[model samples]
Target chain A: MSQPVRASLWAGLYCPGLPLSAVWDHQPGIGPVAVHSHQRGQARIFQAGRIAAQHGVRAGMGLSQALALLPQLQSRPRNPAMEQRALEQIALAAYGHSHQVVLAPPDTVLLEIAGSQRLRGGLQPLLDQLVKTLRQQGFRVRCGTAVVPAAARLLARVGQHADSPERLQHTLDALPIDALGLAPGKQQAIIGCGLRRLGELVRMGAPERARRFGSALNAELDQLYGRQPTPLAGWQPPERYRQRLELPVPSERSEALLFAGNRALDHLGGWLEVRDRALTALHVTLEREDAGNPIALGLSLARPGFDRARLLEMLALKLDRIRLPAPVAALVLKAETTLEHRPPQADLWDGRNHGDAWPALLDRLRARLGEEALSGIAPQADHRPEHAWRWVPPGTTRVCTETRPRPTWLLPEPRPCQRADFRLEDGPERIEAGWWDGQDCRRDYWIARDGRNRRVWIFHEHEPRSGWFLHGLFC
Target chain B: MPEAQPLQHLLDQRSDLWRGRRRPQARCTGSGRAELDAWLPDGGWPCGRLVEILPACLGSGELDLLMPLLAEQTRQGQPVMLIAPPLVPCPQRLHRAGIALDRLVVVRAPDQALWAAEQSLKSGVCGSVLVWHPRGRVDARSIRRLQLAARESDAPAFVCYRRHQQPPPSLSALRLGLEPGPQLTLLRGDGPTRALHLGRANVIELAVRRRQSASAP
Candidate 1:
């Protein structure tokens, strides 16, 4: 079957792109700001003073000279990695809307809308929504729709200054060939031969041009004019291991980050639950500061299929331990290097279930009493109350040791002199462990009801004084 | 679809999530507390609802009624989670009744002032949820969100009513008051006695003693 043709739509989601950069420079409200690099990290002004043909001072003029023309100008060091990451985040957000979203090199993204029309009632509505939603996210984007990728990009870029196709076409015509991102050699070659405009370049025959300049020039021209097929790789499908989230804002608070991180961990953890694959390497990519300065950091899991909660906890721990020099612009989580699937699991049958859902019961106890307070008495090879009772983390399979059968209750401590507040329905069930340890203990445990009509199992531990202790309360 | 039973009838019966239907031979353990279990046809309180518990806000053993059942179920694979259980809990005591503790995850929420535990229930990770909410006036919307979250997960949830302000209108299947038990009879020494009084749907059971005093030989 022939694949359906996709008429693409592009909304420059980076609305107010320049304004954002300008505002970010002043964010810390630090000394008069500029966004240019310096050997001493000193800020400089852009387009200092030399006038350009378009009536504005050209960038890179001498700072001393530029000060005479635009005295208020400020500049700071450029950040590109931050820029790319932010764009990628925006791209990912865009991808959530349509499957065929692709990231373009140098802050560009493509969204194929051939099939997403019905999702918004029609193509125009979809584009409108795509624009509106992004705008609500604080982006000031100029959007343009066209069947051609180059045309769409050119339109969104230039649509700000003009509206008509002919006017927009002139804007594209005025752009130097360098805007194409090709080498300067090609730009010089094009201009050197008197070829000044894209329209003029398109007028030439491909075969004639190829005969002189080779097919690379002809191909680029065809690609630019949409003469030959101009196919875009819609958004790249993320690897099987990725964490996603939808929050009101990209927050920077520590607790908020953990909350968001917990969600991401939950997502990643759920996937881990179904498979044996363990996340060995993880990368948290953030695109918030500015895409040009995207932040990428990583953590290596100690073992495969690591506990997700533990992993998230580690991230929060790591985040807490490290100082964030700058405010976070955005966050992304990437888990890599999955290894052999060893699913750490509980036993098929624990000695404690007693034909009931006892494991679940204990969980409630822990949740209620507190994790520190919740414990199980694993019967050891001993009859002594202390030996019969061993504190074990609940996940361990209950082991039944063939010694004196452990009594259900022990005196919290064997206290002397009391035929106290416990009733015995039957004779005491005796137990004695720890003979080898020399701290021998003998106890008579009984299942008794208190005066209030509640059941409790208690025991008397024999000592030099022969005492009674309230060990455990039966639920 | 045939309406096999009314909603109340359905509540009177329990079925394994996997079977999709209840069988006559399915062995269901009634609460085993006699008259109280008889009041609940399913042999206990409603399975998929919240039981608001209110104590002295400082007293102990408020959970004496529900603790054992929780211990018994946790010994098996299905784990129960208490979202904001008030106490750190004494697991050694639970183990005495054959309850397993390793599977229990007690999340401390006392420190978190905002206390947004709603998301935990929505995630559907636990077999049962116990939320200890501090005293605050709440509206119907928050209550609905919590109820919807628990119902959606099919996880039985209990929101313990901690204070004595007017009970907020709720979709909770059961509402319980756990005050002091009845006066203790003077035995070995004179001391105050307390009992657990339980009420559900206007039906009341008062001062059920959790433990009897020692008998004089």
Candidate 2:
């Protein structure tokens, strides 16, 4: 019996003009935009949209020449932060379609979808859905599928479609040697030899091709043909989310810092969802120009949080309290701490615990008022009423021993009092401890009712101090 | 699926499923004072609901009435928060009453007390929230909102209103009017209006009498 060999399938998604596309998505209908970058002290086009390209603008064209050709061409500086965020978003979208996703930078995403074809009903429908979703997310994508990952990426990059290994190989052979991304010197040498296509280069003697073009061309071809395994390090969601962004202009207003911080949080929320983690603490740093240290605003959540609205609300509160020493030129947002998020178990009848809302509110209050504003009461091991207790940070664990009923309120110091119009309801509970600390106290405690019938806890000092004093109140 | 039905039934029966909140259990938490617990519904203070406490005056043992609930909750690792308490809390006294001082949070902003209480109740981080609305007239709508918020979480909420101030139209799950001599009168609840004597033995009185008798010789 003879067995037929089955071909593995991979999908490649490429965005031709990602930098310009990201800017266009943010500032839509800004009349034919071109993303420009400084090269050798000259402004050069990094990416140009279809509209800009139609007006005779292209990548590598000098900005001055392009502007002269099309007066309506709106050139914007390339924002790497925005481009990176957009790429991460594309990778996240691909993750939903397949388990193994490889991020090819500047920008493309390759997904292993061979096994997922049957589950998704077939490759066409999956690709169709992916293209539709990516377009809806403000991206222009050219998708291609082939038998090998490298061939898929090459086909996608070149806007070619190949479904079978034989067809992919044929297309690869006919592809220009420049498609291999070889060094410019090697590519020029290969092209200068009158070998324009890969098929012509392959027909040459192997040693001759290596000695002239070097082994890079052969290595890329071998990987593309599956003669050598193309092991792509699959894109993994980052362990933490840290985004640094430069402001368009320096501003001393703290509110301006918050505006930039919010943009970072939007990306962070997406990243947290991708990584399946909840943020517990965040550090927002304002990079100041000529400053002592970066103004760091920290938010600590009582419970793990992911909601962006809540995060922004807390940030707004925190930002209001920061007094900027100098103008901030840039801002950085870091998820300083995170926890594996486990969604609260839904109750069969009561549904989910809405009690989690308080942590966010508490965090907001703490962010505005400072950590010292909130404290928990904890008991110390002293016998003196004032010395026996202390104020501790909330959430601390302390042991409390059971004793008799005690007053709810205690005075800082016992105030001298007259017994006039106050009826003594209970009397003479003697306490003789606390002699070891030199401030020995001997007192007889009593419960009294004031003229207004308010209950007060009073005590009389023994010996040297015979006067009655008010100690505490029971409410 | 057929085999799972019986398993599901057993799970439902034996499981401590927190499907929303069930009715107060028959073995509810005791009020620490035996005399007080006997008069209370479910043999103790109810859980997962708002209780309106109307004190005749400040320092009328209103805190003592809830001390047992506070102590029990803190012992179980559930925190207790007091929002805008009328008087400064003595941590030593609370610790002596078996309440963990570390588990007790006192929020002192009077204007934001109700908001803090509602947030704390909904936060589920605390076992109970004691909100003292001393000055402002809290409307029925606010009370209703608080009651609804309390029902969504496991923590019990207590709103303290001064006595003689007309009760808000919004009804809480339970209402008790505290009088002098540490007495509690049920203002409203599922049960009938009645008085409860929370009179415990005054250790001061007992000791004084004992000393006097011993000196008579």
Scored by lDDT, the top model is 2
lDDT for each residue of candidate 2 in A291-390, tens digit (9 for 90 to 100):
6698888888888867677788888877777777888877788885556675655457867454564466568667766776677777677655657667
Once fitted onto the true fold, the runs of candidate 1 whose alpha carbons sit more than 4 angstroms away are: A1-34, A38-76, A136-139, A160-196, A204-217, A227-237, A240-427, A432-470, A473-475, B1-217
The model with the greatest DockQ is 2
Measured on C-alpha atoms, candidate 1 has an lDDT of: 0.51
lDDT of 2 by residue, B68-154 (tens): 778778877777888878667876566655576766788767776777777777666677889888585667777888888887667
- Interface root-mean-square deviation, candidate 1: 8.2
DockQ of each: 0.10, 0.34
TM-score of 2: 0.70
Residues A104-171 of candidate 1: C-alpha lDDT, one tens digit per residue: 55555666665566787976687677677555443446665555566666555554333334554565
